[model samples]
Target: MMESQQEPKVTIPPLIPLEYSNRMMLKTILECGDDQIGLFGKTVVVGGWVKSSKEVKREPVAAALKPPTAAEAFPPSPGRKELSCVEVVQSRIPFFKKIIRVFGVSSDSYPGVREKFEPVPKPPPPPPSKFFLQISDASSISSLMVVIDSAVVPVSAGHVLPTGTCILAQGVLEKSSSHGKQTIELKVEKILHIGTVEPDTYPLSRKRLPLDSLRDYPHIRPRTTTVASITRICDTLDFAAHTFLHNHGFLHVQVPIITTIDSEGFSEKFQVTTSKKWGLGSGSDADVRHETVKAEQHIEARDKSKLGTGVKPEVKEDFFGRQSYLSVSGRLHLESYACALGNVYSFGPRFRAEKTGSIKQVAEMWVVEVEIAFSQLEDSMKCAEDCFKFLCKWILDHCPHDMKFVTKRIDKTIVHRLEYMMSISYERISYREAVDILRKVTDKTFETKLRWGVPLTAEHLSYLADDHYKRPVIIYDYPKAVKPFYVRLNDDGKTVAAFDMVVPKMGTVITGSQSEERLDMLSARMKEFDLSRDQYEWYQDLRKHGTVKHSGFRLGFDLMVLLMTTGLTDVRDVVPFPRTHGKANN
Candidate 1:
């Protein structure tokens, strides 16, 4: 084997001093200067989108004078302007002193020096002044007053930095004593406008844009404060979920997005086909299928008229030779892993083809599905409960800045909701108990009547979790007839070991159930549900050999975000693209 050569390392020189170019985040700026004032002298670089900008006048520095005569200095003449200036300069003491460089000043001169007062000619007015820009990088936002006095580049003909411009600024950290408070600020020196947005034509504004309008411009909406904050919350949730799962000894797995078998075994799936009529060619699979169908229809008409015997023609094959679809859930694939891995989970996008018009519906969404082998229904529920609580507490501790923005703008009760989710124990009850609670509520009206064997509606779930309990509620043991075929049938044979975790404002954020491990029972359920046995033969094989009782659940990742952000009533608002019944804009 040949030996590999080492590559040389490349380094970029700093435009600002190395000490200040530590690239400190805005959130930590206070901590850097709070205790030790030494950090205040260093220069730092900050990058963010400009929130606002305003022009301000600049004042010239005060001129220095020569040291006063012995008689003038000893008496400390209050009437003498130079004497008063010296006293004011002396008050600053050892902490701070102005450095004045006169034409003939010596190095050992006294602190206050006076030369013949020659009125220096004032420089011409600075080419259109710069303004203070309030900037935020989404994580931690701070204001930067970038004056266009020195080498600061001019943005345009007359204006300074415009709002919404993304710039990287190098500046000195200084404490402001102007407004009686010693607040920190960045005196920007060199600015690199990484991105410039024309304020008038920009889709995102400093002011809150209407949520509907924002949905129309999905590509650019992330730049807005509302969407940006929600995106951060989602990112944090992803981290929290993975951290919680990994910490609890759950192996993360990736499942296929396209498959032949429907996890739910329902017709509500986005069909994937390679058949094309007008696009690919004339003699394509689609054309072949169409001609065969036409010929069969003609033959059938002739046979109906007693002219000939008719037979249906076989359909031609497509690319896959059989029908395929985008996965509606990863639960079935996750089940295969759980049977061997003991504990496993998968997090990714899932698709549905329902023409749902409700605010909660979307064609594409994210699901965090977990499966654990040798675990019963109760064990699965406990793990799910702990995971949910852990995520709630994790976001509160890690994403304080974004959560504060959400609480103030989106929902005032968001923090309280998260706290309640974390602090209180969730209420757990069987399907029979849940129906009884709904039946006793005679005072309130329900759009759909509450009863046994019927699938639970959103309103019913919300009322139980939000209004009735005022906290999260996990309802288990759903009627087998209403749930999917994979759910384990109870001993009584009436209900399945299924559960749903519903919370205030958003119902049914999570759904899980114990999977059937008995081959015969699972096959019987598949036949009962009219699902093809041939398609699920692999699924049944898991139960055929050494099948251990396993349970799992899926949390709708988008719904979780929507619940945390109260302002987003529609599920479309939380996702990157609102892929609904009609709209599919790029």
Candidate 2:
């Protein structure tokens, strides 16, 4: 029998086309799944324009190949070459060419390569694996790990990857477990540059970038870990809110932003307009000016007439041919739907025009509004508590990484705070009881503030949440005079069945009450408040036909985020670009 010797099988990584490779280079090349052998420990060629460079003084090869000018520095010329100042400066360092070759391990060894690159270098240097791998999907979960090509090092926190840059990472893939799940990670051995480069326009970096600095770059903030974590948490919470309501048989309704009624009755709204200016005159500049002057004179004459004969100016001729404003809350509209749907909720942007300078005010903000028919104030309170607790639990379970990052970096006590709130029952007290408690306090500032009819301020609400309850607390039965006219009048006739949900850090994040179902009472209450009866015809119609017992609450979504994540002093921090009183930034 003759022994036969066989040659070893040779495998090669499939060559990616220039076009396909071009797209791969534009983004961070985390993994190369095929053709592992071609990249392992081989001197591959790559070429591209220098995106960045750093001087390698210790390399004898660089010292010997130094060029006098920038033009002579790269691909050294046989003779002297003229170079510009920028080129001269760029030549002294190693340029990260667009097309480069990485002579390193295969993608299979990426995990081990990443592990080997983890230890800090001598002199407390940055990680040798200059770039960090970031893999994410639309859901913001199930990220895969791959090494960032060593050539693409992040210089600063705000440094952004160029639009297009082909990168070849020769690394080994190793299996690892994170959050109790098995996953593959790439350990890069070498980075090869390819001959393609694009301009860097997106703002991002791998440093400890400040959130304040990224305010102007909302579109790109999601690339950063902090902002990415926020986005993920926000998404999870939003889903959880809807899920909680849907599971409870609450119908989701999309409320219109532009409306004819000022639901909040605060008269703060962003009026919608189609024309550049309100069309007050028929035609011509002179005619328009004459009409404007005539309108002013009419207003003066009307005021004089009011003083003499108590006459009011007719406002029907003004803009839009009617009085209208953007909705500040969707509860009123949803209330109508609630009557039909049993339980309904509206989630959308709500506009306001209050100019107070505080951490809690914004011209435009998201609101989670719920209206329940045949429910009392206590039912609304329970619903509010359940919704908040469900949201916290859902985010914590589904977005563990994001929640961990947020709690540790943004708010140290987030999880604990939520857990404590869920376990402890919220202390329920009437507004009169709260006033009595405040009056009993030794704090002299509250000595004269034991009034039964005044509305509670943030300070008072904080005292209840922080000092009296030490958890979220619900204060109900406020004086009717201080509450909205829709609130049901209590047995005392002076108070109403309204409640405010106050948390430890965020006071009064939600305000709600049961509606007065009696048509006569509601009408009289509206008249007492001097509100227009015609303005609320639709709202009154709900009571006229078959008004049932109902209750609802309005929650400031941004304020909730602020309470859950960062203890932001200004509500603007939570929103991408908040529209404040005097400023509107895109």
TM-score of each: 0.76, 0.66
Q: Which residue pairs show collisions in model 1?
A: 20-43, 65-113, 65-114, 66-113, 66-114, 66-115, 67-113, 67-114
lDDT by residue (tens digit), candidate 1, 476-565: 999988889899999998999999998878888888999998888898899998988888888888888788899999988888888764
lDDT of 2 by residue, 420-495 (tens): 7666777888888888998887764742355778888888888888987788888999988888788899887898
- Which portions of model 1 miss their true places by more than 4 Å? 1-24, 30-38, 57-128, 141-145, 150-160, 177-182, 278-316, 565-567
Score candidate 1 by TM-score against the native. Answer: 0.76
lDDT accuracy of residue 427 in candidate 2: 80
Which candidate number would show the highest TM-score if scored against the true structure? 1
Best by lDDT: 1
Distance from true position, residue 49, model 1, in Å? Answer: 1.7
Which window of 10 residues has the lowest lDDT sum in candidate 2?
Answer: 23-32
Number of clashes recorded per candidate: 8, 40
Q: Let me know the TM-score candidate 2 reaches against the reference structure.
A: 0.66
Each model's lDDT comes to 0.76, 0.67
> Residue 564 in model 1: shift from native, Å?
3.0
